[model samples]
Target: MTTAPTPVPTPAATELSGGAGASGTATPVPRRRTVKLRGGSWLATVPLFAFFAISFGLPAIAIAIGAFTLSSDAETGAGTFTTQNVTDSVQGAYWTSLLSSVKLSALTALIGTVLGLPIAQAVVTSRFRAVREAVLSASGVLANFGGLPLAFAFVATLGNAGEITKLFHLTDHGWSLYSFTGLTIVYLYFLVPLMVLSITPALDGLRVQWREAAHNNRATTLQYWRHVALPILFPSLLGGYVLLFGSAFAAYATAAAMVGATVPLISRSIADALSGNVLVGQGNLALALSLDMIVVAVVVMAVYLPLQRRSARWLS
Candidate 1:
């Protein structure tokens, strides 16, 4: 036989040697190299990161620290850690203001959801592109149309000497611009449009195929909505409600300008505390109130995120 029989390579040997041929000389495999970011690449984000740190992060840190600390004396400028500010924030008039804020936020969120859902649905299902565009454009503008200008606009329309008040003789009918009812009306001006903008996408995500499938399966319109549509829409509806609640709860300038501290809102209370109108040496108490609002807002967002995630599962 002269030459030795050529050895057969095993599959494992071939794989390990990078599929080397029968010659037995192994081929080198090239390793994947990770691409690292260049110094210039990171520079682009520095400005944005710095802006957030200065504007939001620093202020938030100050509020958190100040909430739990009290000055020993104005002259000494020494702060000692304490929870009395938190305690005081939840008692007496502060408690009442907190309750009023909760009630107002809840009421406005409910009303906005109820009124806006139908409008969102109508706009989403509309055949005309112009109609949808107009509605959406209007909603976008109105949703952001709040603060002092919004308050002033409502005042010009519903105040004591307002045109509607004079025309309908509302003052004689016992309507007051500075009352809770009036505040609710003013809130609705923005709340309804916000809800519309929020829920429109959710409504648009409802596929026509779902309704067709339901109809094909001999399902009634009510049954399809009750079983399929509602379940899918529930998460979105709840998310929108929580978002609206947080927004209304944190509102300051509109309520402050419209009704002053007459409505006893948490925002107004915080303002009073900071300005020394409510009590002297109560700046820490204002920070505590702010912390409470932050906590409530955090809770609302926590609830909203999960609901939004669940809704996205179906819609996506």
Candidate 2:
């Protein structure tokens, strides 16, 4: 008698259905798992978002709300909303203080931009990697090495009784480290380094091919810079200027430690208002001053962001 032959199963069929075991019992087939990718929608960012909301969003909103609200007794919290505080902030002494901060910030920002651009260019063009590394390292350090320590260092190095002051007889020459000029000079110590750090990438973005092409056109160095480099670099330059301006405008500790109330900075004025050094129950005024600062900061960011995006296209 002819026995019925069992047909061999194909690999696909064996995989889909279970394969036979050595004992001739069919094995269980493995199921396929579908993976879901967790993009930004995951809960991992919740903590960070919550922290930011608490730390910055809350405080900024409070400041904005408080700016329009009048101050009441210490226990009563805020009073009715009014524009008095806002108006007061832009008038008289507060106005002067704001203008003073702007002048100082602009002066230092321009000076830092001018001084730093060449230094950045030199570093980018340098053949020695060590030179570039050292310069960039120094810049990073100096840019961050500000506030009280920087103030004290400048005082000890250039103050009335300082070693350099005595060596150069600067006091006799009326070079007061407690004045506007001295404050500016001290600001430059950090500002220039900041400029170098900010503009180095933009300078590096200046391709060698641009220079070669300029040379091919028989352009001189000055002509190349005027026609090719400066035009391209202008946005980055303006962006750096705005950056330096913001840095100087917001600086408080250094100016306070060095020049005190003589400079009339907006930050100092705001501090004075908060501390009741000017008047009691002036928290409303402090809030207003803070609001003014916020406005200025908003304007700076508005200008900076666009320029930064534009520069990135050419430089990046």
Candidate 3:
């Protein structure tokens, strides 16, 4: 009994042996795999990038290249480098069309903002959730409710043979649905809704505390809006104006189906040129007009970006 006792393995030696086993054999440890996380992040965006390239980037490149090139002959269909298309786009009737487009866009944007702001404000402050939901739903539908069907609907509602026109005729009044004014009226149908959609979030972003503070200072409702609210909302308002302007400017189907080519909008002119209805060698001119539109859009976006950023600072 006093003989030397058998040495027992320490806990550290047992752990190193991967726990005690009846056979006293160590279990093999599996090697850990290190996953690389860097390269795969961009994989998700590949589809999006491809889509953008095919849809927008390729077409834009073709338009730019075509704008600077002239057809050598109608039969040969060969292109030669030239800048005459660009010059032609900015001169004569084409220039007038551009100006007309600009004017129409500006007018629509202004009118839409003025009419939409109140509707948005009302919706934001409404006591009824159902009313707010209805307004927003209608605004969403009407905002995008454009194109040929929209034009047809307007024509049926306001054209010479339209109900409104007949009603006005009954009252011994005249109404024209083919004029610039008439086009503007048709444009308002979609434009006002677009404005409502655009400004609603901005209006909602207005904090209640600001209003309470204004009231605490004994400020009237008009005074509060004029000073505190207007200043905060101005950036969003301007951004919405730019968005509406772009919408009206880029509109083609609605105007084309509604008034034909009677209105000399830039988009209509571009269509005419591309359809070969204007003149020979005018295809490049169509691209030039498109380029002009792109430039105008770019400028509009440049202005909009800053205003949108400023608005986000408060709204967010």
Candidate 4:
């Protein structure tokens, strides 16, 4: 019987073992000192750090401080410090606006997910290439066409005595352009596209082999999706919903154009407070509003982190 040849270990392994240099002798590798960054390199970054500190951090910190500071009045000398600013914000219109914002965000997320899923399914399963391209392209265009332009389009299409109303009797009717429902519709227009973009990749990642295997086992299409597809797609859908919620929650210009100062969504309320028209020296209200917005953003971000982790685990 022939003996198998001894396998040679790699150089790296040999080195780790101290390299059998002589018959029984092992050569040791001299450890090199860790490299240290020069003071110049650290100094170079100071300007960049300073730039960010001045432009971004400082302004944000200033706003935060101002939100807690009381302005000088005839009674108060130059400046004063009090929690009344925050208290005032929490007790008044701010509370109503915050409640409205949260409600609208929930509605927008629901609408976007419900609408986008069907559209994504159409894009994926439809037979016609032209239709798919048109739908995708139109979604892209409309996603970018937010804010004032979108508002005007809605007005032109559905406003009182708009072209549609005059030509086709499509009155603003029960769907007036100046209501919370109207803003929800406008938000969905942009939000659905966002959902489509987010969820399409997750849908595309559903392997054909899995579907085929399920089918060979006599699984129906719905059964296959239920058992094999949805489990994988759920995390992504949840993540997308969180994202859409954030987007709609932060939206300002579109709500402004549509409501023109009547309805007080959080963003509109903040803008009004900041415009210095109604609340001149009380810009602190705007800051407090910003803080409220920040809280909402933080919640969304907190939810997003776990959803992202789930997505990564699923994808892996």
Clashes per candidate (backbone, < 3 Å):
0, 0, 0, 0
lDDT of 4 by residue, 1-316 (tens): 9999987889998988888864969887889998887787889899999999999888888778877777776455355677787787766678888888889998899889978987898787878999878888887787677888988998888677567667766543465667887778778889999888778778777778898999999999999878878777877888888888888888888888888767777787787777876757667778877877777777877877876777677666
TM-scores, in order shown?
0.84, 0.84, 0.84, 0.76
User: Candidate 1 at residue 85, lDDT?
Assistant: 90
What lDDT does each candidate get? 0.91, 0.91, 0.90, 0.80
Error of model 1, residue 150, in angstroms:
1.8
Best lDDT among the predictions, by candidate number: 1
Candidate 4: the clashing residue pairs are none
Model 3 per-residue lDDT tens digits across residues 1-316 = 5999898989888778787588867676677999988869899899999999999999999999999998887798888999999999999999999999999999988999999999899999999999999999999999999999998997888887888778768235546788799899888899898999988888989999999999999999999999999999999999889889999999999999988878889999998998878785588899999999999999988987887788789888
Off by over 4 Å in 1: 1-53
* Candidate 4 least-lDDT 10 residues: 168-177
For residues 149-206, could you state the per-residue lDDT of candidate 2 as single tens digits?
Answer: 9999988989988889999999888899998899999999999999999989888789
State the number of backbone clashes in model 1: 0
- Candidate 3: where is the Cα deviation over 4 Å? 1-41, 170-174
Candidate 1 structure quality by residue, lDDT tens digits, 117-199: 98998898889999999999999999899999999998998999999999999999899999999999999999999999999
